[model samples]
Target: MGAEGKTPRMTSHDAAGRSDDSDHRGYLDGQLLIAMPVMGDPRFERSVIYLCAHSSEGAMGIIVNRPAGSIDFPELLVQLDIIQKADQIKLPENAESMKVLKGGPVETGRGFVLHSSDFFIQDATLKIDEGICLTATVDILKAIAKGAGPKHAILALGYAGWAPGQLETEIQDNGWLHCDADPDLIFGGDVEEKYLRALRKIGIDPGMLSNEAGHA
Candidate 1:
């Protein structure tokens, strides 16, 4: 899960033959994806995903709303040898309350850190947007354990991945609705309310949504 290699650069072309940032080319990068009511996959039902990267190559995101049951951050630190059992009670306030989420179905054993831009590690962090960044190395975890990490963050086990054009096709098929992302929406403690909150952010009432896909 170490992100030590060179990060892939993704660019997009505009109509006038000009190149632009992939996120600005109508892609869902750095946005929140709200699973449609008719979602067929049980793994993603009512999921609220924060897209970290989206380009012609593929798309990658973390499910921010699904808690990784039975996983506790302090215990995880002890397991990883970042701290000892006796140190659990001494964890900082943010570390004590930090969430552990099931990012997605892929690479479930690995860890990904979706955090605020206040902290960074050279070559290990991918700045997703103005306020968010993704780091898949254990270094950030050590920082968090030491109370030297970002202002806000969540540790996700695994991530959602799509092949080239696969996500675009899903979007065209009405599998998702995307909207701008905010720190509160991404890092809030209300896990069960994220899906509904994301829908409301897109100006849709959850109670009014139907299972007809496009009718939402």
Candidate 2:
């Protein structure tokens, strides 16, 4: 909510975020997972995920394109007591306009912040890549509320998760496609355009892609 307003408190339906880092990194850390049109689950249809950690234990990521429609960043800060409702006018531009996304299908009650590497908190931030980082602690939220946080960030409630080998099997089944992460794609303001844009990033025409999963 940077220069826009305070972050809004998430309602029951808005919950869906939380994450932990994995160093064992089997594969997919710092990658983008684009949902296939044939994706069986409606919840993840056309979703774009920022894979933070993946290994034999499982995988965890935040859905970058799914916004918590009813939640606002600045309003959230006020609800969490990080800032007074009257002090909202004092927030920096980036802080007020920062977006809040619906991260994934799990834990839909907590919060996670995925941001640029320019900011970090000791033992709190999980560096996902050279350009991206993730922080779930309230301290970062406090910093953002005070206008002293990362240069770019998206707050998400909940996260998507997969059990051991679950993601791999899904990919084999064509449930998702993989690609390198790009800042514009990850932190872009256009939520509705992300799905189509991501497909184009990998040189695929979304309009031509079929819903039936295939193996080549």
Candidate 3:
């Protein structure tokens, strides 16, 4: 579904509004969704999504794999005017190596930072899990430019979302397989191996996985 604008900032309340609702059972918040081969949507084919919030209302997540091609973090800083071009080389090691990811198909123009919880802004950060948080403001970009941001972070240019019962139906139809999330799976630098790794983590060998549609 479509959001309001290009840069819609999601607060903790917005992300986890129905989190405590008793009817919001079996939600997959803070988990990983691995797309099965039978998935009908090409955008999510072979995708590995990190569920940030899940409740009776809906679900939101970011694809941890799928690098945003040729998008350099330092150059993005310059483009956003967060830092001058001359200061590119002065960026921290973490900033220099930060990977820019295509989070999903929706709101592709916006940037969302899925980061470690070490850094936070009073009302801008949405803590998805113990060590993971999501911040969608440019203020975090400034912090990164100054080397004062989270220990680990990735810039995702959009996010995946599902209406109430949509994700559950997909799971029931064997469109996805879910498993627990870890820092390595979410923040690891190897963008290409996440899908296969996630399958293996759930004890399913990729080679043996079939395109059959059945319960996950």
Give the alpha-carbon lDDT of every model. Answer: 0.81, 0.82, 0.83
lDDT for 106 in candidate 2 is 81
lDDT of 3 by residue, 1-216 (tens): 232223333223232223355664577888999999888899999999999889878888999998887677888888777888999999999999998888998877778899999998876788877899988888888898889999999988889999988999988888998998878989999989989999989998899877777443
Best by lDDT: 3
**Ranking of predictions according to lDDT:** 3, 2, 1
After superposition, candidate 1 runs with Cα above 4 Å error: 1-24
Candidate 2 deviant stretches above 4 angstroms:
1-26
The 10-residue segment of model 2 with minimum total lDDT is 1-10
Full candidate order by TM-score, most accurate first: 3, 1, 2
lDDT of 2 by residue, 1-216 (tens): 221232333332221243444455459889999999777998799999999888777888999998787778878888888889999899898988898888877876678889999998766677877999988878888888777899889998888999999999989888999999999998899988999999999999877888766634
* Residue 88, model 3, lDDT: 96
| Candidate scoring better on TM-score of 2 and 3 | 3
Point to the candidate with the largest TM-score: 3
lDDT of 3 at 190: 95
Q: What are the root-mean-square deviations of the candidates from the true structure over C-alphas?
A: 7.0, 5.4, 3.6
